[model samples]
Target: MYTSTPFNIADQLPKGLQALMYRAQGAMDNEASGLQRRSFLKVVSASGFALGAFPLLTQAQAQAATPAAAASALKPTQQPSAFVHIAKDGTVTVTINRLDFGQGVQTGLPMILAEELDADWRLVKSQHGNADPAYADPVMGMHLTGGSSAIKNSYTQYRELGARTRAMLVAAAAAQWGVDASSLRTREGVVIGPGGKRLGYGELAEAAMLQPVPEKVTLKDPKQFRIIGKPTGRLDARAKSSGGQSYGIDTRLPGMLTAVVAHPPVFAGKVKSLDDAAARAVPGVKAVLRVPLDRGGEGVAVVAEGYWAAKQGRDALKVDWDTSTVEKVDSAQQLASYRALAQTSGALKYNADVSPLATAPKKISAEFVFPYLAHAPMEPLNCTVQLSGQGADTKAELWLGTQMPGLDTLAASQVLGVAPQNLKMNVQMAGGGFGRRGIPSSDYVVEACAVAKAARTAGLTAAVRTLWSREDDIKGGYYRPMHVHRAEIGLDAQGKILAWDHVIVGQSIIAGSPFEPFMVKDGVDATMVEGMKEPYDIPMRLSVHHPKLNVPVLWWRSVGSTHTAYVMETLIDEVARSAGQDPVAYRLQRFGDKHPRHRAALQLAVSKSGYGKRTLAAGRAWGVAVHESFNTVVAYVVEASVKGTTPVLHAVTAGVHCNLAINPTSIEAQIQGAALMGLSMCLPGAAITLKEGVVEQSNFGDYQVPRITDMPTVAVFIAPSADAPTGLGEPGLPPLAPAFANAIAKLTGQAPRELPFKLA
Candidate 1:
């Protein structure tokens, strides 16, 4: 999904060229260290061609500086599109700034640019970008992919890149023909001249490379778009389907050793004693050394020839963990504390006078508890690191599927004792991340760098690949914070909300993060209260209490909306039911004129799903919910049944208003994937709990994700619009659980207050 924010791109060259320059300088430095000078120019010639295609600097100016001096002058203001390459074969390769990670961005972003470039779809291809300053999110000015901001932030930038490249190609054609550039027009990679002369983009590529870059170019009107709103298949879909795609876990480097760490059961716990004799004696075990862990802890890393040997060596290792300095958190105790805290308002966020609640004719009080959830992406976390040289000459290179590659690069540089400029990050395709890969701490990446550094200190010269088993990933500390919500609502005879008082208790996801100062304000984490009383007009008091627990918590798929939407939507349904009004009508009436997108999405789902017109079968009911997150609105009309006390979702029809759809096929897939994940949260054993400060669930056997049998039939529909695209990855998720819960509540005459529903 794309973000809807604009960014600046006028001050520099692309990072690919800068990286080439750096490599050139490194080659010179390696020669000084008694190493034979490698052919750096040949190594970067392909990327140099792409960069040179965009005239950031004239030939004279570029020739004036030595390669090393030019490298030093390359800064962080570079634009990403400078690397867009038009190959001699007519293949237009556009490098994406964000990780694809199964989100279809590899194709969706290129679709935007190719649409404007008027390139033939068959000749278009895309590649993953590295952790370079040029790849930073335009609005955030950082390398990040969370909040579904990829497409929204880069839509215009990429379009302009295409427009500018087209303008240059036209200019080049005009110079060759001795005519005004306006006499030439492009269509499907061909420059059509006034006299009917035609030239393929491939024939004009070299000349286009020499033409001056235009400062501005007119973007095509939405009405003229031949690709932006079209449904296009993903470019990597065939590769992934044919099992030819490589993810982070599939990364392999020559002379690379695999490592697995034995972390303390309790977070931030230190090793009291160690016995690595058995580990070291294990066959293929090259080294066993203690390394610093994330969140201020220490762990033992067993480096071996392969993953199996590393796991075997890790299993053989024994160490006494010291937990005296860390707080022991038990899930049962924490829930009790959260429950008690939710009973009273802690810090006031929205202080509406809910004094009318006591005098209202109708009142409802509800308390909802949501447990911690692990990201549990299909591919477990893994990072491969290779270090060269030492001191200031030390250069580090990392290969991983990172959501924030630039941040990870900086973090890895610190861990490897190298300057950030000396580090290179190769972003790989990720199986799935949700929000786990975008952590502010860069925990997994830092840990991998630590293991590589430890191996280097242990006299090992090979690259180190740090891998986490499925068990290790589940037991990993970062999780969605457990939350408890208390709500008191007063409604009139017509189900109009008079006053609503709500209190939420959870650990702050951004409290200790570098984003804390900006994301947290006035004793409240903005994410903690995002979806409360939204998309509908209401007077309410919302407060929050963030407890400092030992459990490490991070944002899940939709952040706070994962829990908030369920609370608000389900409760609103209950209020409508109590007043004897139809849920959809009640919601529509309350939507009021301010939220047309919300009303449109809801109406579309209802009309298309036949929610009000078609009668459900016996024991099944209609479930409806709408929510806006990441600036996109999604509404779900679902059919659900309580099958012998277990809720079974039969089918779902989604109406999404992301403004403009780049690739409707990709949007549909994202919604289906997100919906399934949302349903996973309601399944039994979905919670991540702690006992004596240790994660109780280790793998799929204990921690449950949705199985094939649990998948519901889903249909997706997009609301028509020419507005810029917002986020699609997360908005599809927030409404799913609430819609399901609303149907179950209708069937059982009970409003479930906690996750992993226990109707039996």
Candidate 2:
């Protein structure tokens, strides 16, 4: 039997990728042995690689990136040298610290940097960075891209990086021509001397690196921005459009072997016995070995020459699984348990008086059920692990679209018994991750490493790639936790909320991970209640139950907002209807002066969609929802018409107030994609149900998602502002389904409470 539970995914899902990176080498509870959080960050900021007044990357450093010199990030007063690399041919390649898994940071981040660098827009390109410290998030001090933090957190950092690169080029040209650097200027990748002499960045690049990175540089003013606010195309747009783009799934190494694991039907179920006689007889079969799985599970990995062979070999295997010790979670039974818990007191998050609920003139009680959801990224889950040498002196290289390379490196190092410095992670572009690739456990990476280790132990010297098929991934654990929300509201005669007693029952996304100490407080996991109450300003007595079920839950697209926004917005619209007020007007009334962003976004969507000024078609009705997540506000105004049992979405207009739109096209793309994903929640077969601890849906046939046929005509309008840009990758998704739900309610006099629409 598998070992008893210790630290699992709830601990790893984290509060959107914030974890203790310095203490990753030891046990989950090892907090005191490593550098304290604040102290470690201070050290990194103070003494971390300072590229100021030095070559961006020395010849030796350029050839190899070791852990001792891993951090190349500059301080506030220093200049960034690692992110931007100028080629000899004048092509500028910007290394993005975050994974560009369809979020469009592939171009947005570089736009910000290239704008300040005064580089030729046509020559700009982007690539993903490795596990080096230079690529870590400035705020979190980890190599993370979740929480829509990529552009938001790196905005100013990239701006300064570009500016400093420009300054360094100027200095290089100045020194070459023996002129005062102050007398020189740069424009469109060229350094202009006093006599109008121009030096292309390409000609000055080598010299520029030899010169020092400018200690202080001037960032471009918003009005002077040529690239930042433009609707620039993604660096990989043409490749993606032409079907030539390479994802992590396309990784190919010389003599690399493919692997497919035969996991137990039940999560964390142990393997009692196995017979690989048929598997071994198959041609191209390498070897099959029993290995430990994530969260204390056991499975057999089949290694072969190719994916088809591995899959075929896996299909031929026979094994008996012991699931007696693990949880056999039944969806129906879990719902029953959640329903019962809704009546009891749980961990108090927000303590507001709910006494008015008993005697208020108006009252509404509602309950919601959201089923477990799989990420189901197009790329599936694949990690290619290559190891050379053995044991302590062994060196490793990994290729994958990993969300948390820092943690992955630590986990891989321990698994292969290699030093952190000896390992190199080649970050690849992912087709889509939503949140699967960024799991706290680095499960996929560890599994791949385990398979590679097992292969080497079996005398197979080639690199091994552990690939999960569509079935394996869909049935894989670490899904969006199913949530049950109960809300009892007390409202005044005018539709103003007087009191809201709310209860959310779901597994904590970050309960046991090393960061639990910092995130979960007083028995409350803040992530579980993110979008519960806000903007509208209402007294909400919020409580949550972090039930310990065997199921592992992680953050999906927008984290908790995936469900919270739906619950909050639909309930808000329902409350508005009960008050005999127009949902839009009622929402505006509630906005007051405290939420001008929300009000403006809503007004923008209304005005843009002609929501109130124009009449809809015969069967059409307007649905509106506005929510703010990750410091960005998105308002959706949609038209819906019901056809029998199906709710037909006609059109959608989005109003986004994210302070700044770095690249209008990228923003539009994110919103368009996110809105479509949001629509998925209402589609049939959208829910992932567990029966007897086994996932009932194994692939897209049983577990459905939003397809092109389901998409509505969508238009995105961004609010104008000079403020630093906020995130767009996730904010657009939270309010979409709720807005659609609100519209469906307008057509039919009922508010939908369950996802995948159980309406008859």
Model 1 per-residue lDDT tens digits across residues 1-760: 3211101111232455335434433432333224221332232234432542321222221232245323433332233234477776778888888999988999999999898889998999888777655566766666778888889888887887788678878988899999999878999999999879998887777566555555557999899999887788899989999999999988888988999999999999989999999999999999998999998999999999999999999999989999999999999999999999998888878988888999889999999999999999999999999999977889888889999886687678778888765777888999998889988799999999999999999999999999999999999889999999999999889888899999999999988876666667799988888888887777899999999998899988999899999999999899999999999999989888988999989998898899878988999989989988888999999999987878999999998899989999999999999999999989989999999999999999999899999999998888888898887778889899999999988888886789977787
lDDT of 2 by residue, 1-760 (tens): 0000011122243454444454442332232223243443332234222221111232223223233323444442123545766766788888888998999998998898899999999988888877755677776667787888889888988988888778778878888999998898888888888778998988877666545555467777688988888887788989999999998889888999999999889989989989999999889999998988998999999999999999999999999999999989999999999999988779998899989899889999999999999999989999999989865679889999988888898889889898776777889999899989998788888889999999899999998989999999999989999989999999989898889999999999888765677668899887888877887689999999989999988989888888899999999999999989999999988888888889888898898899889989999999999999888999999999899889888899999998988888888888889999999988889999999999999988899887778899999888888899887778888998899999999888987899978779
| Residue 68 displacement (Å), model 1 | 24
* Model 2 ranges off by over 4 Å: 1-79
- The candidate 1 region of ten consecutive residues with least summed lDDT is 2-11
- Model 2's TM-score against the true structure: 0.92
Give lDDT per model, in order. Answer: 0.83, 0.82
Off by over 4 Å in 1: 1-49, 52-81
Q: Per-candidate RMSD vs. true structure? A: 5.2, 7.3
